[model samples]
Target chain A: MTWSLPLRKFLLYAFIIIFGFVMLYPIIWLLASSLKPESLIFSEPGLWPSEFTLENYVKGWNAVGDVTFGLFFKNSFVISIIAVLGNLLTCSMAAFAFSRLDFPLKKVFFSCMLLTIMLPTHVTLVPQYAIFHNLGWINTILPLTVPKLLATDAFFIFLMVQFFRGIPKELDESAIIDGCGPFQIYSRIILPLAEPALLTTAIFTFIWTWDDFFSQLLYLNTVENFTVPLGLRLFLDSQGESLWGAVFAMSVLSLLPIMILFFLFQRQIVEGIATTGVKG
Target chain B: MRHIRKNTITAYLFLLPWLIGFFGLVLGPMVSSLYLSFTEYDLLTAPEWVGLQNFIEMFQDSNFWQSVRVTLGFVLIGVPGQLFFALFIALLLNKGLKGIGLYRTVYYIPSLLGGSVAIALLWKNIFGFEGIVNDFLAILGIEGRSWVSHPDYALYTLIILAVWQFGASMVIFLAGLKQIPGELYDASAVDGAGKFSQFKSITIPMLTPVILFNLVIELIKALQVFTPAYIVSEGTGGPSGSTLFYTLLLYQKGFSYFEMGYASAMAWILVLVLATLTALIFFSSKYWVHYENGGS
Candidate 1:
């Protein structure tokens, strides 16, 4: 009993369009605000610009305490790039050990890794803050970048592990028979095949690091060291000082990088999400 | 013995970096927190052991209960709302229509950027008194106030924000739907199963595990709902403390009020609550979460 295609087709398209609009509304508002003149932001906030201007973008780009957004973007880009690379190298290697390599206490260790996700980061925040403070690393970029270098992004590691588990075990066996060592197989086979997961991890790490406000707010105390979120939030005071237009303008500019990145590699990320679930 | 040693060495080598980090960053601090919760430390001075005084004081604190209520409100409202929105869209996207990936990508942009200060600021404007939301309501002639500042509506706005990021869950559900085997749908159709019935039995049961996974992660994330609330509340949890989530409250006490010990205790209670919730979920899974690889 085959049903008519148009009915299903209409429903699908209808849902997609509606959901798409819901998702794009805030983004559209931000983009529009970014191009609006300062006065019009308050006088008239519309979906389309009444009179388009590049003032907001220009001010936003240059108004980072005379530091310019170029520096902020550079800071964020360096942090995210280093973090993504660290996550890729260390996380995949650790994932390989848990997924394929047979070793003593592997079960116990893998379970411990899983348990990390269950533990809330807030619970550890106090003491970790203390340690960083004691080490005089509280105000440095070391606290943010160093942890990723050491594979503390357990979510990404677990994701890579799940992806690794999906690979045919026979490949490892065949590679072994062919005299390819464990590192060789992991590097040559597992890492390459896990590109989707790797890409997803990279995209997520970039997004998270780019968006991470708390850490930036904590470590980078000075305005010169401010990331985008911290810089944006530094303005909009909820009490008396409410710069809604400026806030929106900055908000829109801040979202552009991640939005563009998503548009570019979202296929791989979505596929990565699906594969992680199924592999688990 | 030789091969096992070699494998063990390899495993340890692979794990060396993470283990060092886990110990120095996660494990050490985790244990230290257990001690910190019992101390009266304020960063400038060494912690003096106060025994269970912190725990005892927590029970009598009104802010503690308020935060608990706020956190629970967030978890309850946010998780289910997110799941429903995600599944609804997943079902729509699962129809294999044209430009499905495009819609998925667009919907997911918020999820990726949602946690950042940018979205939080956007949320502030969207939910503020003269923001886009109120502007739309004004169009409909329904008077709207500053929802983000209002205790009655602040949490709900955050929940809406949470639900809006259902892209990840939707993607997971999409995957689960794809693996449901077309033969089952075919068989169900032959047996006179309608769309709803087929979805009720075949789809629901098969996708229970994915739902459970999403649920647990969402619960964990919801408890850590600090960013939006922090930004929205102007970092003070204003307007009668409406946006004072548990983590936000912890931050206020530890960082703002300089009550590190008290905050540590609050943090532990948070961990306890989440751990309990996760355990309850796992225990209840036997009733609702069906697994193909497991025995009934």
Candidate 2:
């Protein structure tokens, strides 16, 4: 308040604009390089194509040996959609149970669930891979989808539990008095009312599963089974002749879905992630 | 009591899927991994009891120590770097600014895609000899090396990547900043408190809990970092193993080399390390973290 209002406003805007541009440079650079010819990609350092070309897109789309890029996109979508549905259905149910119903060992189970949040995923990686391998689920999408279907992501379960707990207990009480079962109350009341939380879970599940590379890489090997991340990894060649333009082209394409989701549901995603951090 | 029995059954029914997952996907594997740590097992062969040999071997293994050093270095350096940027940006954005939404979105984009293979590849290229970074350095007449391939600089690039993706922490910090009562600032201003004093007394103490949350989360994440390191190093953890994250090393031991027992020991070590660190933070919170509602 001591300084001139215009001066403060000008300084803030200038700093934000400069910082925003810096943060956005990599993405913008990727987009620009995607449009550039392969020869000019590294030659031109600035984030603008001197000579635009669609050669990279065409080549990148067909670059993989046998499988087309469409297959990878379809595979990624299939896995992510299953994961989203799995989290929405299974996590919400678990959350409803934890929030509403009285159960034996509920406290113990809940604490165990919370403890799993701190357990690193890699700790279980070896044995789980062994289990799946024994189950003959290796090299399939089963490894990715099955755990999700079983609500292994305790983070989303915790998020939904918080949301369900916020709903007035009066609704559940009245429903029970009307002879409604727990399932009915969950299906008819809690599920419909927790739309924002469910949306947050759905969006996050889709994006994280789609972007997940490590697990996908571990379970999936064949080109026919590769997800988008694995597919993009194929374009990279550190020892051989690398296709920089094509890689950038596919990279931009890979980020499109996530970028669109972030733009459309920015507030929900931000709120969901922030609240989880604070509440936890 | 009869109603309680029925309700318990119904709740268990609702929790059936998660219970199955907890037992199958999580608990079973965790127990098995612990057992595997003390046994010699390759995926093809049955596990042979080896007692504490795996744990003993880990301490003597230079590569294991290297990974420990690398992971510790990452957590110590990267966590602070990320929190600093996040808090600084959060403070800047807390100002009632125009186009705040646009700026927030732009800043958040990196965190969104930071773990993706494409971003990792982009980072690798950006620090390469002929990449954009070196091209920029060329303008200043300074020769630039391939930063990603240099043992000394490879880890720093990863740290820079970590700091670049500070949007999630920033957003959380922004939320925390917003929760601070505006009345506090107004009251402080009336009391003739300078801005620095106001921030130190009013802002920092209030945000201590949020800071703790961010620190613990960042520490856990920093310790387990794998994807970017894997991608940038091309799964070799090359450039003299400087980019070899603990998880990547464990992955190699379990999957690549098929030393399941060794990897299991490493995993348990990671768990123990994380547990101790988290407990330490929790134990120390009494001294620094302030709870306004006084429940602490």
State which candidate has the highest TM-score.
2
Relative to the real complex, the DockQ score for model 2 comes to 0.69
Off by over 4 Å in 1: A1-12, A64-66, A100-102, A166-186, A237-243, A277-280, B1-7, B293-296
TM-score of 1: 0.92
Question: Over the stretch B200-289, how does candidate 1's per-residue lDDT look in tens digits?
Answer: 999999999989999988888888888998888888776687777888888888887778999899889888888898899999999999
Residue-level lDDT of model 2, residues B1-296, one tens digit each, is 88888888889988999999999989999999999999999998899999999999999999998888888888889999999999998899988877777887777889998988999999999999888788778889999999999999999999999989899999899889989999999999999999899999999999999999999999998998988999889988878999989998999999899999999999999999999999999999999998899746
Give the winner by DockQ. Answer: 2
TM-score of chain A of 1: 0.86
Report chain B TM per candidate.
0.94, 0.97
Q: What's model 1's overall lDDT?
A: 0.82
After TM-score superposition, the amount by which residue A226's alpha carbon in candidate 2 deviates from its true location, in angstroms, is: 0.7
Q: Can you write out model 1's per-residue Cα lDDT over A24-74, one digit (the tens) per residue? A: 898887888767777776569567888888776676666555687667777
Model 1: DockQ vs. true structure: 0.60
What lDDT would candidate 2 get against the real structure?
0.90
